[model samples]
Target: MNQTAGLAVGHYILLKDPITGNPLAGNPRKIENIDVATRTVTWGTAYAPVNVTMNAVKVLFHNAAFETFGRVDSGGYLTLADQAAPEGSPANAAWLWSDGTSRALRVRTKDGITSSLNNGGTGTVAMGDTDRTPAASVHQCGVIVTTGTLTSHRLLTLPPATDTDAYGKWIDNTCTGAFSVVVRQSTGATVSVPNGAKAYVWLDSRGVTKLM
Candidate 1:
């Protein structure tokens, strides 16, 4: 019974009259607290103190994307990567590089932390030395153009276990050249995005899902 309201802070919700099956008069209340486990919401006037079933509340969602890479849980809160950049340190980013020997993609974040990019499997990819982390969020999403001849295919890694509901996609930008952009799962599976193609790779409770 996943009756929890997938709402965020500062979002407005309409409170309905439980008995009449209609919105309560003057009942467009601002959401203050959400209890997912209990599927309850505590909102409305502080002086009045109203609690209601989450399913009865109508929520308005604002469209937005993450400005920083982190873990976004079911509650919609973000937990940024733990690494830190020194003052005046050059902003950095990382990339997913394919390792032929290991047959996996290795990821290195901006903070110089190196780890295997999970391929939705048991094996971990070998790490590459190149720093592929983008400097800003605006540069995060979009087509990536490679500079030189690609030795091995580059992959876009999926979010870790913490970001179970989140997914990522890579659009192959090359028009004529046969560029290989792949989505590497943590479970050791690989899905390729052909040149001039795009695919959505997401991880859910069930497993890694691909939407081409």
Candidate 2:
């Protein structure tokens, strides 16, 4: 359960009220330590100590630093505490978040990464002649397959990059008929990918670049 909250000053995540999204109303106790192994949280100090056992719960991250990412676990451990997902007993569940129109979870499912533009699947985007900038899911994809025939030298324009954005996609011009997809970026030079050839497009601080 994701409980959105204004970022505080530290990495301390409030243990939400079991019944409400409001911070656990009490005499404030700053968390000083977290032991993932023992599944215990310790606050206060040696003289006035406090500890509580965590039963596999997801806590909303609070702090101005996390305003962009919103929520996180393990203080950016970026690793699961347990083994694989769907552990017959433990059942490592994958988390999902939504705020922007296009964002995806990197967690793997039963089979593998899918190529669907819907449901935030990390996959491919099938484009026709008129498609300009592909969706974020397609930008995350390793390959992009076009299926349309453009009248002129198709301008495969890409979107501008932001601080939180970085992606690369392979252009596979599998469209009907023959028309070159001119991969161009606003701040960088352009590369015309032949109808039957491929080229890699990625973003850097200076903007998008193509690697043929």
Candidate 3:
């Protein structure tokens, strides 16, 4: 039974279905091997032996990579430890997906346009001694310049956007505190804005917050 006898050059021999975790069923769909000891096999000895690999898979995680040849778990699945990485690298694990035991089948991401950045608009937020956290809509208006008078230190929490999120703000610390407007995302670290300063905040594809 020659599996590659009539197959085309670019035939995609699917070892397993990643979404459903199913193996390539039937004999015609799979090429059999004489033994499992050897990693590479040659089709014909009479002619020049073309090396064919049974399975060569490399799963990347964090700052390293792991590879295995012709190795399957009890479930007939390659069974990567349910991992993912930033599109650029495996080290950028800033934002995490759902804490699930299985890998995602598919993922979708879109760039978020703040109201101001989207339409060249501007808005003014009036700060108060009590009202420090403004609504998410206030930040959407492209560029923001804050107004208000403070008597003590205050924090202004900014809402995070979707992928590729960014906004610019001119902080007017009217309060008499050491740090007037300390900006931060709900789930991110903080960047303090002293008495008077300007900051452009951005979130990359991983949604890690940073001052741009």
Those runs of model 1 whose alpha carbons end farther than 4 Å from true positions after fitting are 1-41, 44-148, 161-164, 168-170, 175-179, 185-188, 205-208
CA-lDDT, candidates in order:
0.47, 0.53, 0.45
Q: Give the TM-score of each candidate.
A: 0.33, 0.41, 0.36
**Which model scores highest in TM-score?**
2
In terms of lDDT, model 2 sits at 0.53
> Which residue pairs show collisions in model 3?
115-140, 116-141, 116-142, 117-142, 150-175
Candidate 2 minimal-lDDT segment of 10 residues: 82-91
Model 1 Cα lDDT, one tens digit per residue, 1-212: 14545675556666555566677665666666777777666666423446654543344433434434468789997554433332333346454444446644455556455454443312222214222323322123333332323345665454443353354434443423455545554555566655456555555444445665
- Assess candidate 1 and give its lDDT: 0.47
Please give the range of 10 consecutive residues that has the lowest summed lDDT in model 3. Answer: 57-66
Query: Which 10-residue span in candidate 1 carries the lowest summed lDDT?
Result: 121-130
Using lDDT, rank the candidates from best to worst.
2, 1, 3
After TM-score superposition, the amount by which residue 138's alpha carbon in candidate 1 deviates from its true location, in angstroms, is: 5.6
| Model 3: residues with Cα > 4 Å off, grouped in runs | 1-120, 162-178, 204-212
